[model samples]
Target: MEIFPAVARVTFDGQVRSFDPSVERTEMERGLPKQRLLNSQVLVKQSMTLYFASIGDATTFESWYFDVIKRIGWFEMVHPYSGQTIKARFENGALGDLVPDEKLTGDFKMDTVVEYMR
Candidate 1:
């Protein structure tokens, strides 16, 4: 699998991570709901907004995403929480939108959502 191209020069900001635990639950009429763990492993999903100081870096990422990542349908990236290289796919199989930031001088921004998979 191809690894995702890095575009961020510094830290990844505005990142949101969600953990979906496998579970089964049953509602009781007179008492608290009962739940059981279906699997020990939890699914991870992340949404990140990346900042690029250089337009060249942002364009590089866009080219890689279209040429490689889109074709492969999945890629490897370092998980922020786990700090390990993990296989990931674009959330809902959609490419992120790259736009120039007017608020920041000579900067670009892109937002992406990815789901980690085994």
Candidate 2:
């Protein structure tokens, strides 16, 4: 018998972190006719912001960080919170500039708006 280890993480092109991937969803609805639902737009392909936080004492700098941070294209994402591996694209991302005196470690955070591609 074969088994896989239980892993909870957020990953992009190999950069991995064992943390909750915050998934945001837009309530597609109209403010009329008793607030009707607009549509059930696949759920994944709708506009969303992915929140990723590093584990304690860990640096945000990863080998695949740049490619994920700078590149503009669709990529696969493993969302621990949603429990689904979905296709998404980077709409925007932000990180405060690392200072000389400040240490670069732990809980380095970034929130990005990603539109599901597939």
Candidate 3:
């Protein structure tokens, strides 16, 4: 799968701006009387945000993304940072927020964050 192409497009959202994804590794640990021991260590979450810049792009993105949010499932994407294809979904709350900047009346940008377990 193609990782982050300087700029890339997805099956759902076309022509997007993406930055390096955030990958997290988390574990549970406990401390003993004399030493420390690890309990559970595993990859926790991988997250990335895709930006839809432009009113037309934002509108299309909103429709597609909100649709996914309504359903309870994961979508597919090529992770930008890890260079791997992963099953991901929109981050828990507030799927997409589109607010027009002062410079343009209709021009706007919206960012959608997604998370994956890999």
Cα lDDT of model 1 overall? 0.76
TM-score to native of every candidate shown: 0.77, 0.36, 0.50
* Model 3 ranges off by over 4 Å: 1-43, 46-49, 68-71, 101-107
**Which tens-of-lDDT digit does each residue in 1-118 have in candidate 2?**
1111122123342232232233444555665333334454533323322223344212333323454345454556655446676665544533333322222333333333445532
Q: Which stretches of candidate 1 lie over 4 Å from their true place?
A: 8-10, 102-104
Identify the candidate with maximal TM-score. Answer: 1
Error of 1 at 69 (Å): 1.7
lDDT tens digits, residue span 41-79, model 1: 776778887778778888887788778776447787788
Rank by TM-score, highest first: 1, 3, 2
Error of 2 at 81 (Å): 3.4
Candidate 3, residue 48: lDDT: 32
Full candidate order by lDDT, most accurate first: 1, 3, 2
TM-score of 3: 0.50
